[model samples]
Target: YLNSFVDNIDEMKEKERYLMEELKNQENNFLGIKSICSNKVDRVEEISRLKIEMNRLGIFLKNNQGLNDFSIDDIQNKIKEIEEYYVSDEEINNLQNKINEFKSKIAYPIIEGVFGILEENFSIIDKKYEEAIYSSMGSRSKFLVVKNEKIGNELLSSNNSSISIIPLNKIKPKIVPGDILRNVRQLGGIPITELINFDEEVSKAMEFVFNGYFLFENKENARKACYDYKVIGVTLDGTLYDPKGTLCGGKIICKNIIFRRKDLLELEQSFKEKKENKRIYEKEKYNLNELKSKICNLREIKKAKNDIQIIENSIKFLNKLIESKVDYSSELSSLRQNIVKKIREKEEFLRRKNVLETEIFELKNKIKSKKEDEKNILKKILQLEGFRRQSEIKISKKSIGEREEESLELKRKHLLQNILKSKSKISKLRELLKEFKSGKNENSKSHLPVQFQEISDVLDDFKLSSNIFNVDLKIFDVKKEDELKKELFSVRKEIEMSKNIKK
Candidate 1:
């Protein structure tokens, strides 16, 4: 009986030990529950703060002055109009201003030791043969056509370093061979010296310069006269054929007053384009600022929504822990699962945000690249203009001749054609860029609720379709109108030149 009692006491001791262990485990579980509940409370506070921030950002975005003032369609239409408005008149006015400014800076040299200056300026009698005389004279046209030899000698001895005086008195006319002359006449060619209407005093100078040269109607006749008949020949288009089986022909870029005008016009056009591009960049930057604010608000709303979800999940877990019997292992497993799930959710949000931010960064980089390209193009245009102006200024300071004017008019036409082509390309690029921006804006709208996204997409599609239709119609109308206007302008210019020639 005593042994049995001892066993019972030992059993009670074992039971006490078991009870104490269970009590310690319950205390540990209580501490864990407290920690989890505290964490849930902290998450609730964080969620509330995030909600407040989101609401604030939303309100700010909704009330944004610039963004709220205009509808998207209105803004887009204004941008399109700004892009399409023609600035050619501005270019022309600026060019005229620059030409006037350059002319104001020119200073002519004064000869201190020269004798009496005799200026015997001769005009072209026949406009049809003006090109032939100008081509035959070549660089000699820059020289002053004077009749007195002593005046030329005195001018050459003067202190003036800029004078290029040519006296007709000292010139000896060259006599062409009879056989060559006969061959040239047989080829429907006229001697260049015979085409000019000049004073008798200057006849020797003209003959000395172009007595052996013959002008033909075309290159084929000129080549026949030179290669087959063995005589020097020139064509109206400035092709030169020598008697020694040599031919020189191509477009001539003469350094004269007429070319200077063309260069100035091109520079003005480039400047206007650069200015327009700068304005576009400025406007885009302003729009980007508004977009950035809107994106910020969207990101905040997304973060707030995620925070609310995490907090709600944490509260639910805490509630489950409070209502159930304290099972430490099971509660730990549940808490761990919740933590892992929350971590995955946060990671997903971060990844989405990163992707959005990356897209924004890429868009910014593209804009920067375009700006750099535009800057480079503007720099190249300015450099070319500077070089052209310097070269033009270095040439002789004389009035533009009829042939030079004609050449300049042709060059201007060619430049206009090139400008038209460039403008077309620029317009196409602008349209593409506008479409890309519109698409990007549409993509941004996808982050909103599904119902809102659908509505926005429908509106965007309608606007896009309308824009496309209008653009097609406008392009067709503009093309026809521009062609007619160009033809009329050309005809008017020809008539004006004809009247001037008659005068």
Candidate 2:
């Protein structure tokens, strides 16, 4: 019976130990379930936050896309406006046609009705002689240089006022004597005929026009040499002085009628230059438009690609989170209930944190706005202080009486009247004194002859003494004592009146 009792005690001890170990294992499982629930809650919260941020980023991207489109449209509009001022190909073509037409007309002869005379026959013999020939003959250089006298007669009989005929046969060359030519050369002058180059047939005509006229460096030397030598003189600047005293002088303009070929060439060159400039500007405008289009396209494409990449990354992150998920079906119901309660607590804490953070942000914004208002108020205060200082300075610059007293105006007018009266009295005194000194005062006519003569002698003596002493003693002259006294009294009265006005 003793051995059976001992065996029962041992079995009861082993069963108690097994029951304690099972309780510990169940507690550890509950803790693991709680930890898993907490991890799930954290992951869910992070996903919610990501969704909100993504929504905000999407809206921002959408707005930026709209702005980019508007920018592109604005650039396109500017390009269109620039196009309005751009020269077109059609206009350039029309200008080119006009230039061609001008070239064709320039090749025509200056004079039209000469017989068998082509435009080549009327050429300027030498370019260097163009100015001298043009100046000597004037518009006659445009006439055809023909050997036939009948053509010249026919041109003159045509009665066209614009046409001039210079016949080589009718021209009689003026022979300048050798002595006159030697004197002209000594005086720094050259014969005008020697300065020009022309055909032998036109030699007589050139000599008839400018043979005797000598060209000098300037007008003064030409005028002096011309009068001294008794010959016609022409200055290098086209100033002409004839022995008959006829003078013709002014600026010598190279008339386009004289250089018809040169004028045509210059006009054609100018037209080509303008056309080339227009083409360059058009090419530049086209290149600028193309560059702007390319830049805008690249920007749009890059922005869209970046936005797509960000969305793809976000989707990848979500997929990764889904792949990392674990099943928690074996968790205890009590732990799951605790996890749900804790999640609600965590949400409430987040809400409170958001509210507190929003309050902090609002307070910070209020502080920032107040600081800006303070700065604006300080600026206004400084401006007002500056105005106040300026006003003070202006007030200080004003006269005290002008600023504070209305009666000063009346005082000024009264003082001016008194000053005028004093001036009049002084003028009358001066006139009386002058009359007395000159012996022309009617009031002093009753004086005896000897007394007047004696007064004149005294006045003459006083003038001599005053001149020697360099003093103004005229006021003390015996004949003008009363007038001088009156002048002194008037001056004193003016001084007193001025003092009273100041007070």
Model 1 TM-score, 2 decimals: 0.27
Alpha-carbon deviation at 353 in model 2, angstroms = 90
lDDT of 1 by residue, 298-406 (tens): 5555565576565565556556655556666676776566555555554554565466556666767888999999999999999999999987866644335656666
Model 1 alpha-carbon drift over 4 Å, by segment = 1-120, 125-128, 228-230, 252-503
Q: Which is the leading candidate under TM-score?
A: 2
Runs of candidate 2 exceeding 4 Å displacement? 1-144, 157-161, 256-503
TM per candidate: 0.27, 0.28
